[model samples]
Target: MKKFALIFVVVLSLVLVGCGANSDKASNEKKEEAKTITFQSEDGKIEVPAKPKRVVVLSSYTGDLINLGVNIVGADSWSFDNANFKDALKDAKEVSEEDVEGIIALKPDLIIGSSTMKNKDKLKKVAPVVTFTYNKLNYLDQHIAVGKAVNKEKEATEWANDFEKRAEEAGNEIKAKIGENASVSVAESYDKQMYVFGDNWGRGTEVLYQAMKLKMPDSVKNSALEAGYYAISPEELGNYTGDYLVLSRQSSGDNSFMKTTAYQDIPAVKNNRVLEVESSKFYFNDATTLEYQLKTFEDFFLGK
Candidate 1:
């Protein structure tokens, strides 16, 4: 009787343990159901979380995510280097374009960047990587695409609308102040090489030509618009230089271009219509940089 009673107790104990284990498994399954989802991605039909909690952005669009109010866990060095994004990305880990091990270590739910990333295939083993054609779309469209990829298309649309409205207002103000007919040109110098930009390039061309509705020089339009940008020798810079000039400097490099007889002879340079902005600050087409671009124009054009 004693042996039989001990056997019964042991069986009852085993049954309770099994029930507890089943309950825990159900709870875990529910939690997982709440967290993950299979969604579409740029690289064909890839599975991703419906709403990613841990995002690793391996591109320059980190500011676009910040504008959408998303939490980021990892990013490339460019995101950390932006002065406006430094504080927000301070705690974020850095992952390189080729760093599959580093990216996997972060255990990110979503990864986003340009399609040109060399290790994109390898990175896929770690997480769903969404790729965008770099510089293929306009800034607003780029943001919208990113938003859709992250399941935040509505938020991105609202932001894009607000940005357009603000840009139009600012453009009107600038046009009113600077005159309707004034032509603006965007030019950048890197390592003593000069290039004229179209409206879509990151170097203030968007604000100067597209947002503000400013006119581009005929020479610039003819030369740079088709290719989106055109390289020009400093001696021939006068052709592309318009009434208002935006000069972007990547490094201190030979600023002798500014003192060149060809450069100084331009009417904009003579009239002090040149706005000098840092290349790092102006080389991005994201929301943060756009805001900075607008503010700079307002201050300069409004004479504030």
Candidate 2:
């Protein structure tokens, strides 16, 4: 009787061990099943991680990703320059398309970049890659598209709706103060050339024209409306100055031309209607940037 009992006990122990092994295998399979999702890119559909823990952004969409609450492991150099992104990106490493080995070391789960990038083939080997055509979707749609990629569409939509309402109300109040026909122009001075922007270009152009429904100066419309921006000489700057001018220039840039008679004599300059913004701060059209633009315009127009 004792010998028979020992054999039965051994058999029961083996059965229990096998059950535990099967359970662990099943758990691992479930994790693999939940790993990825199908993302529709501008080019075509591709499989991407459903919940990307580490994302590397290679273009100007850094601010868009920041607002969507993605964990950025690596980003382009330009992202670091954004005032709004300073705190959020403090821990992130600066990387570009040129840094393939560096990006590999970071082990990003996903990558986002512009369609114009040249290293798509190499990046795909490291992880899933998705690219967006700039302005292919309008500024608001672009944010929504980003949310979709990161599984935060609802949050993105909510923010977009709120911004629209706030911008509309602000626009009405600003129009009342500045008059309906008062025009607004956004101009930027770079190293050697000056650029005038239209409704879609950054530098608060979207908030000023697209969201706030502000008027664009005819000279700006003719030169920059279709092309987004027009490069012109410094002497031509006065022609583009509207009743209100939003000027974007580097903080330490040479702006001595502002003292010249040609620049001072512009109607807007004479009236002190130019609102100077740091070029790097106003160069992007992302949620963080749009918020800054909205507040800046509100202060400039209504003194609020």
Candidate 3:
């Protein structure tokens, strides 16, 4: 009887140990079942569990995320295109820059931002933050970087490919409409100085000259290649004078430069070939925003 009791006690202890092991195993399995997603960021690489259900976008990538069909729980209330966030991003929660408390209140899973976020620590404390830097005119690289960050690499590549194809097609269409030899000049005025875009200034200019096959007017050819943003007098407008001129309106609604006699006398202006573009649109070179810039040029130059 003593031997049988001892054996029974040992058996009970083994069964309890086995049950504890099984329970531990089940808990680990549950933890493993939670999904993870990887994000390629400018600061470094980051991995999060599953698709971020609550996201906050701080800067320019807002449009890119919207295009990818990501649900944004919070966002900065800045004018991306002089349009309200509601207009640009429907159903997304809007937050202000100073509203740290408000952002935290939302309990976001992820925060998509640009390098401009000043409060990195505060933002990270709220949630995982992924930041990006804008690459001028290299829309493909920009798309790939942002896409990988959001687990939409394939979609980003497709969008980039389509963008390039459309840009090339637009270039071809512009070339056919305006002739291959057509000279074009793009410029903006700030504080009484004229800033002409160079070949390497932004992707739009590269597309206009390299892809569209538009020639830089002889006056602007040398200056466009010059280093730094050079100032040109309204009298020297002839130097930038081309078959077509693209001017960007000043942010403060200042059009004083356009009223200058020298500007009015330019061949492009006299012939009404000058197209006015928004300064904001002319400056940003992201894949998503680039389409608008390309379309603006196509519409202006090709009348399409």
Candidate 4:
């Protein structure tokens, strides 16, 4: 009779242990379910971590993500190419939409990319993928959209407002020093092509024309404003010159045109009213680059 009681007690203990294990599993699953929330992406709603810890950027929103305090483990080549992003992305690996296996190895909690990225479906299978169409929203709105993706909309919005105010103030100061009617032109040369940009394009055009309310020459406005950028021959560069010229130049680019008589004869060039910005740094209009640009422009006009 005593032996039977001992066996029965052991069986009861095992049953209780099994029930507790099942209960703990269910509780864990419920907590996991509560940790994710649905985000209304550009295409449709998808679940994303409430606080993403490891993010992989497959697009140009690197500066935006950095500004919003996201921990990026991987990013595209273009982001790595941006000079201003060098220190910020020092620990990040160069990843692209084509790097499926590489990205998977990074163990990213979220992935942000462009709408036209080829590996969208494949990436989604590895992690939640969010994409944005370029220029679909203005720069500030784009930042806000990125913030929402990372669950930091309020911080993004606050930065946008503060940046706008500072830019406007700086523009007023610049206009006062350079004359409000003075026109400024932004141009850059890469490979065999020389191009002029409109207000929305990078190279400080957004800060100069949009945020600072600086003046753009009629010729550039007619050509680049609608199309974003217009290619011109090196000889025709002078045709787009304004009272002040912002030359977005790369250290290694074919700036041989600068030594040409046609370029030197331009009023802005002859008068030393040209501000040369590094192409890699100026190529992006994100918060990191924009702040550098704003200071550059201010010092160029307001100081020596």
Candidate 5:
């Protein structure tokens, strides 16, 4: 009787162990099933992993996702100078617009890019692809759209609202310090070409016009602001110069243009209100870059 009882007890122990193992496997399967999601992309209805574990971005909007605390696995090489992304993306793989195979090897669960990317069909084969047409919406609106794509809309809205309030406060402070009618202009010299910008372009316009409430020179408002940007010859520089100038020189040691008699004749340069900025940093118009520009303004304009 004792030997029979021992055999039965051993069999019962084995059965309990097997049941536990099966339960664990089933739980793990359920967890894996929940990892994916269906996203309505610009291309059409496509399914992507929720909170995508690996994302490959092929646009300058990498900063947008980073600000939302998303994991970025790869990105385009164009945004190398964006201060917010440079350090974090330093070790990230650099993928080209047409590198579908390259992106596939990265094992991305989702791909984000511009609508103009080459080989869109090939990219879609590897993973779900979402493309953005940045020009269709204003800058802040574009950021919100990107946030929706990454499932970070709540954080994005909070940041946008906070940023707007801060910007308005900063603008009011500037007016109090420098008078409400102070004028500012953004200009850059690139490859022997000069550009004048309005409030939309990256070169401090958001801070100067939108945030600080500074006035643009009539020539700039009539030209650059209407068309987004205006290209002018070296001799025509004075036409766009304002009470303050945000000068971004692309090449170092090319003081040739600045040394010219025509350049020194600008009223801003004569009065020493020219704020020299690195072209690379000033080229991004996103909220992250705009914060950097704000800090710079605090120091330069208010002596804070």
Candidate 6:
């Protein structure tokens, strides 16, 4: 009887251990299932399974993710230049331009990026990567595309709508201040040439020209407006002469070009209508930077 009792006790302990192991297995399966999420790539098409908790952004798409209220594990350093992004992901790790190996080491479940990434194959080998190609589109469409990729399409649309409304209000105020005939030109001096941006450039040209109904001078019509962005001799600045000139300041130590005689004779210089702008905000047309550009324009041109 003593031997039988000992055997029974051993059997009970084994059964309890087996039950606990099964419970643990079930819990792990549930956790794995919970982690799964459908993520759309930058391409705005292909959807793949991504672990909802771990996300790595390799582009300015960090703004979209932030707007979507998603937490990012890592992001490209360039995104930090914008105040909105910097404030949103203060603790996020920075991924360098050539740091695919480092990114893979993070073991992120979803890799969000642009077409500019060099190590696409390597990144994909480590995890699922979604890339988006940015282009000139209606702001609403662009915002919606970003929202869809981040699984926040509805919220993105609403944000875009609100942005458009605010932009329209700002445009109206600018129109009131500048009047209908006030011509505007946006240009940057670089490498002894003047680069002018037009409707195709991703700044606020659409709102300025289309929404606000600002006039484009005839001199900048064919050359400046047609090519979207074109470089001309400093002597050709006469062609860009408008009522308001928005000049983007080249970086320091870039005096190699600006010291030339052609830039001095420009009407914008003589009239003192040239407003020097920050190069970083001028070139990068992301959401946060765009707002900065708009505010700068308002302060410089509208006296707001």
Clashing pairs for model 2 are: none
- Best of the candidates, TM-score: 2
Q: Compared with the true structure, what per-residue lDDT tens digits does model 5 show for residues 192-257?
A: 888999887777787778766788989999998877789998778888998888888755546478
Per-candidate RMSD vs. true structure? 8.3, 6.4, 7.5, 7.9, 6.3, 8.8
lDDT tens string, model 3, 1-304?
9999999999999999999999999999987666667665666667753566788888766657666666777777552442423554565667755678888988888887777677877878888888876443254666566667667788988987777777788888777877888888877766667777766455267567655667887767777656524568656776776898878665576677677787788888899998887676665455545666777787777777
Model 4 Cα lDDT, one tens digit per residue, 1-304 = 9999999999999999999999999999887757677889988998988889899998778989988888999999888888778888989999889989999999999999989998898999999999999888888889999889888899999999999999999999888888989999999988878999999888899899999999999999999999999999989988998999999887887788899999999999999999998888888777777788888988898882
Q: Candidate 2, which segments miss by more than 4 Å at Cα?
A: 1-33
The list of candidate 5 runs beyond 4 A from truth reads 1-41, 251-255
Question: Residue 204, candidate 2: how far off, in angstroms?
Answer: 0.8
**What lDDT would candidate 3 get against the real structure?**
0.71
Model 3: colliding residue pairs: none
Expressed as tens digits, the lDDT of each residue in 211-304 for candidate 6 is 5567777767777676777787666776776887777765563644445577667776777777776564456555555566667767776687
lDDT of 2 at 227: 94
Candidate 1: tens digits of C-alpha lDDT, residues 1-304? 9999999999999999999999999999887666555455556776667778889997878888888877898988877767778777877898887888888888888999888888877877887888988787788888888888777889988888888888889889888888898989898887768899988878777777787788888989988887888998877878888889888885556778888888889999899999998787788888878888888888888876
Error of model 1, residue 10, in angstroms: 48
CA error at residue 223 for candidate 3, angstroms: 4.5
CA displacement after TM-score superposition, residue 287 of candidate 4 (Å): 1.8
TM-score of each: 0.84, 0.88, 0.75, 0.88, 0.84, 0.75
After TM-score superposition, the amount by which residue 236's alpha carbon in candidate 2 deviates from its true location, in angstroms, is 1.0
TM-score of candidate 2 against the unseen true structure:
0.88
| Candidate 5 TM-score, true structure as reference | 0.84
lDDT of 1: 0.83
